[model samples]
Target: MTNSSAKTRAPLSRPIIAGVVTALVGFTSSFAVVLTGLAAVGATPGQAASGLLALSLTMGIACIVLATRYRMPITVAWSTPGAALLAATGLVEGGWPAAVGAFLVVAALILLTALVPQIGALIASIPASIAQAMLAGVLLPLCLAPVTGLALNPWGVAPVAITWLIFARLAPRWAVPFAFVAATVVVIIGVVTSGKTVDPALLIPQLEWTAPTFTLGAVIGIALPLFVVTMASQNVPGIAIMRSYGYEVPWRPAMLVTGLGTAAGAAAGGHAINLAAISAALAAAPEADPDPRRRWVAGLSTGISYVLLGGCAAASAALVLLAPPAVIPAVAGIALFAAFGSSVQQAIDDPGERIPAVVTLLVAASGVAVLGISAAFWAIVAGLLVRGVLHLGRR
Candidate 1:
């Protein structure tokens, strides 16, 4: 490649930097889940760092390769759902090793799903409209949560949320990061002026590493749950996210790489890693780059950012503290405003798929709970299942 072309291709564009920052922006939402997963699995602080390392390295490399190879604006991330599972069930551990055993099982299941054309095809069969609806539904809570947070002390949250909404509504690209900064300043003022309480006199730095141990029960219960979350919450969203941006890639290789990333993270006390849906959209959007070919550089830039962030947990924590809770939802809502609206609009624009898509959107938005599975998985499943049954009945 020529020097000029290489430079142009490098992920240094203003949009790319914004995208990377946005991708990393999500670190606030699920970090507790990751740490809880680590603690539940008996990892020391050092082990968590190592897990972060493994997770970042694997995801970083994979995103670069996948984006470059596919020539698409693709982005990857850890399964927020998997991390949630870790937070909830990570307690059932043989420590970090147990989590790894769970990771292995999850990886295996994903491989099976990938190899089995039926499964992948079935997922693909989901109407783009329905898929979009599901995504929009999943994001609804986050959008509203900030508003609800207003009840708390409105001073910290209310101002931020309201201002963010206003700014974001008017000027999304400029408004999002601005909202985050504004909200953080509010929270800082709250903490300083009001004297909010804190736990642990100092942030804990417990770091240790132990080989993973596998227990059948842990694998079945703990690991399987994490796997499901990774696939449902992380991968499904990832594919939809990529497609949302108009990139086409075979799902199998993507699944494999994500599975491997998760396993590698598990080795370090992290949970399932995979293609990022929400955070990635920030980086991979048409807005991130007017030219899609140059977008891979953005993905690569994100990976490099991960390396830096992953290096120091303390630093990560400090950065996390940089933003107030209100900042997260307000800014995230702002950033996602376009994508969500566009996806929903796209899904409903087609009259043939409108009904099924509407059903999917409603089902996803309902937040109903029958099984332990979160609403995300069920939205897709029920939407497709309903569509299938209707088609057969019509025949």
Candidate 2:
């Protein structure tokens, strides 16, 4: 690269760096969590890798098409956040089969929401505070994983996590990048050399695909939560990021895309495919290109990367096991802390419902699972119930 070209590109480097980092996180930390969720439900390694492959393909194609036509830096992602919701699906009575059925149900919800604005409105009608609370609550337990993960290699991850928290506190822009770098090095030195490696074969994908089975356990338990999670975690955040950047992508088709993609992923041994927010922000921002008209090219570029990876299932498996477990938790926790704080603050800002809102936030952060529903979802339900009862008694 010539000095002049390097200098020219430097101005746009921030957004590019952010975009690349976000995508990396989507694959490494976020992908690892998804695998963990899959295993919690007894999905074999083959199914987990298949799920990742399917999501990448679906997201890649959709993102390329939408962003190109729209002439924006739009991004599409498999529902990484939906891992929280997938917890119940993984533990259902029929396990993977039931989970697939549940995925279809969620897909139906996505289709319905896309076709019906009233449904979107109903989803939107949930107070921003509650949504924030729900988000924070869902993510709260996940944040704790890094801390415990650090215990696995305190000397390695402890320093990385500490450095990340400090950097996140002082330098918002550099936090993730710096922490990721530090963690990667530590994993190599601390975890990898310590002989924590799984058999390379155990981590590779099995190309053999299985057909999905419909089941009652999946419909009642897995499907319901998957729908809620995809909505709460993926769609909600995705729309917010788009709105934040002044894009007006229609929600209906987007929701349909998410639902359908998830169904495909389920059939391929994956769970919860939906839009992405954090990485999408990096792509949609002005830094993707100086002339917004050309931004589609960047989306096209990302899509190409996705396509290559999706076709190579073995690569996906290797990527999943590429990083140390501790690294995933630290990256995720540090990344979401600010958003989590904001949610907590928003949930309690209303003077009338301040006390109850606090209750909502606490319930969500508690990570308590009841009736197979996540704490985040239940927190919203519980808060709404409390808020409703209080409102009604006054009436």
* Candidate 1 local lDDT, 1-395, one digit each (tens): 78976676534475568546755665543443354355545565556555655666667777777776776656677665454334434344355576667777776777777788775565555566766766666555545655666664466566656765676679654455555566657756756776765444224433334566777656755655455445555677677777878776678888877766666655555566777877777777776776676777677777666655555454334333444545444544444455557667866898867777777767756665344344545666777777787677574
Model 1 score (lDDT): 0.61
lDDT of 2 by residue, 152-199 (tens): 757757766777768778976566666766766765664457777656
RMSD of each: 6.3, 4.7
TM-scores, one per candidate: 0.63, 0.80
**Candidate 1: pairs in clash:** 41-95, 41-96, 44-208, 45-206, 45-207, 46-207, 76-276, 77-276, 97-212, 97-213
Find the candidate with the highest TM-score and give its number: 2
Best by lDDT: 2
